[model samples]
Target: MKKISILVTAILALVFNACSTDDEFTFVAKPDPEGIAFMNTFLPSYILKPSNATNLAERFVWNEVDMDVQTTVRYELQASADESFQNMTVIESDIATTNQAVTVGELLALAEEAGLDTDPDTEASNSGTVYFQVRAYAGENPATTVEQFSEPVGITVELVEDTSGEVELPKIYVVGNFQGAGGYGSDWTPADGVPLAASGPAKTDYEGFVYLNVDKPQFKFLPTNASFDGDYGDAGETDGVFTGKLKQEGEKNAGTPDGTGGYYWFKVDTEKMTYSLTKVDWGLIGNATPTGWDSDTDLVYNPETKLWTLTLELTEQVAPDNGIKFRANDGWDINLGDTGADGTLEFGGDNIGVPESGNYTVTMDLSNPRDYTYTLVKN
Candidate 1:
């Protein structure tokens, strides 16, 4: 019995020693790391260059972080419109260097990508500040280290339009058998594609006309210079109007034209991400219409000036509200008239009054489809 008791005590002692042994390691959590500080406290003012600028504008610097261990650190420099960093845009990430320098071009792009603009440049509104901060993480794989972010620094940024004539945004062209010089399915060639007009500094508004023939059943829009990298096609409905927003390298759905195919105006507003296709056939229609609204006098298109021109004679006895109006397709569905008797025409507006009875040369300017204008001069 004594021997048995000794064996049990020895076993208990062995078990106690096993539990006390340092075989299993415990990770004592390190204190939260310290945030970095900007070596250059003030960031210089940034200006957007129309083209790529080579001069470095700002070089952000920060002190190294202490992770309580010898490990390589990865730094992520971030820029944001808000101080809270809710919608943070990382300028640089996974960088071993703590300092980051950006060029004038780079800074401008970042600001614009963040929905910042320079238009209506004013002291109170167009100008503002952007927040810059740094986040440091330790270790290479699994990123196993304490992470800390520096206090945000404010950088005054001035938003301005790039009028240097050196910048041109990506443009979309009408391709795929749009009744141009090439016949049909000519998506691979740039010469055959109809170029769309770009507007605004952002070039988000695209407008142009394409002469489509009835033989071709469909057409699509190419987002590049016939490179065909990103093209947007019919958005599943397969109708003449593709309401779906253009996506890069998206599905190729063709659009069907209406009215046996004619000159169709396409307006693409990237700001709104919407497109409209309208068939335009200008005609003089009203009580002054040559055939009393029964027949229409067509206006020829001038390719050089992008205006509709027509010369006709009118009598002293005015009929339709003492004037006439321009209608598309000889119908009232899309008609334009002068509201203030000014050169500009308002859609579905009042009749443009004639000053006197004479042969007049009327020119309607549709170069900028968003704003239509017309001029009537006595020949």
Candidate 2:
């Protein structure tokens, strides 16, 4: 009887395993007909100006999309010169989030591509409309039928006629609790804050390096050096945004520091309305230095001058293959190089030319935002 029972149990287990394989399910997402909609409050019209080119054209937010079956949704944001979206340019692709930020500079590029000109002297209309659309789809390479595209939304962009050759680089000031450490003045004082340089002519993005002495130090962003009239606190989400209040009023976005802070890369995006602080240590690496492309030499930071300094010997280097770049934390994730060989540093730019093989005092000045520069002074 015992032998028979054992044989029966084995048979039952085998049958259950076969049934489970037969019931295997593969979830395929179906395109939702309702589609996605823009949730942002549209401006009457976008009057673009070179002076405020860095400002955000708009922060296009939308509700979460649906794909019927349970699966991950990928989004793509696009802009076109016409309502038909025949000649469209992708702004963001494969985004899991439901929001996208467009900058004036970005729009200017689109307008230029659309054959629209800001120069009133020309025949092209100074004012025109740009259409935007959002696409949601699934699977790595989804079929056309599985893609859900939103209805085209038009935004009017008027080019402000200007020949002044004036383009204001947008600036965002930082006021934090670790003020005295890096000559940042009194803690939490907007009037004594440091400026985070705009990434370029675009004012929506800003970046800079700062030293924070305290652990978990707190900070805030100010638009000007006068008062906290137009300031930003943490927006509650990670990698922060402006919540429109101050910490004194118990505003939660007091600023999230990288706990054990020393030297950090501070970045802010007004279009995205977010701020971030990344701790880093600056180093020099390249085939120009002693270690070639394998290692990095340390660079010292001065609080008073807010510059990175290093005095070392460099080898004579020829272009296209050999040279140096300023990288952080001994990694290639963040690095700066001279693209134009014009003393200005551009992120992931080309290699800088060695003024020849000799001992020189290298000075890296990132203190002034948007104007990153380096100097090689022979001893």
Candidate 3:
């Protein structure tokens, strides 16, 4: 019995040594954060042009990820519209090389995710930011592999699309008594009114947002930001939400949509000489947000900055194109979305998304006329 037990122990020892020093034993890789970083000099900002879409935007080079052992590794380049990596796009796909050439078109696509538009006709803001990072893994596939991510870098993207053949958009100004303390230089002066932008040079429709503190506040619109040569004002005695017509000459100032003013959406049609004002209170809703799609998470308005802000935890949606929207009065009648996935807002557009789940500060800035933009800052 002692001899048989000794034989079994010897056999077990031999089996352990056989698998220990070979492929049978998987190597555990340790990540080195200090040695991993971008080796390229990142530009402060890039002005992307559609005309140069096929050109090289940049060659992303990075230091080799130190795994503390000799082994093959996979490299993945990630680009995102938000700092939080909320909705990241893996460039091309996972690769083994330390560097990859990104084309102008690819960068432009990332800029679209950031909501930067060079087109003057679009209502979205023209400047935004994109973030990049490198992910290193030990195996061909990411599953069960030792993986780590490099520190992310942010780049500002300003779009300068080819506007050679396009018509230049027109400009209008709004000067109101509500602005009297001079957020726009002594409110009642058309020359000093807030800029109200037109959709296009051919389209005289102008839109903007404004806040009023006093009851019965009045205002007027000027065709130019610097002159009152042609201005339009109220044609009725009482405040008109939509029924009142605009008169170019010999008219009283346009009164508030309601006697009690808070915030309003302003619109004017130069051809029709018609103006409308709708009081709006903005809210955020979607599956990605805590409120889900059925209800709204109301955003607080900061009168000083004229921005709507909300801080909340957001969930990552792995499914494509499922995200969030900004609506007014907790309803879909007036909701804003980013159809182009650009940082700009359309009345009813595509869903906005995030890639990683985290706490974020969501801001909706409609203070600038026609150029509505929003920001999602991860905390």
What TM-scores do the predictions have?
0.52, 0.58, 0.54
The global C-alpha lDDT for each of the candidates, from Candidate 1 onward, is: 0.58, 0.69, 0.69
Task: Estimate the lDDT of model 3.
Answer: 0.69
User: Order of candidates by lDDT, top first?
Assistant: 3, 2, 1
The 10-residue segment with the lowest total lDDT in model 3: 5-14
Query: 211-326 in candidate 1: lDDT tens per residue?
Result: 56555446666655435644666555433445445533345545643425666778775445566778789988655545655767899976545578999985444423667888
Q: Which consecutive 10 residues in model 1 have the weakest lDDT in total?
A: 5-14
Clashes of each: 2, 4, 6
lDDT of model number 2: 0.69
Cα lDDT tens digits for candidate 2, 125-157: 766666677777665642322566655455667
RMSD of each: 16.8, 16.8, 27.3
lDDT of 3 by residue, 206-323 (tens): 7888786567777788766656665787776544332458986577778764566778888888767898888899999999998698899999988778789999999986433688
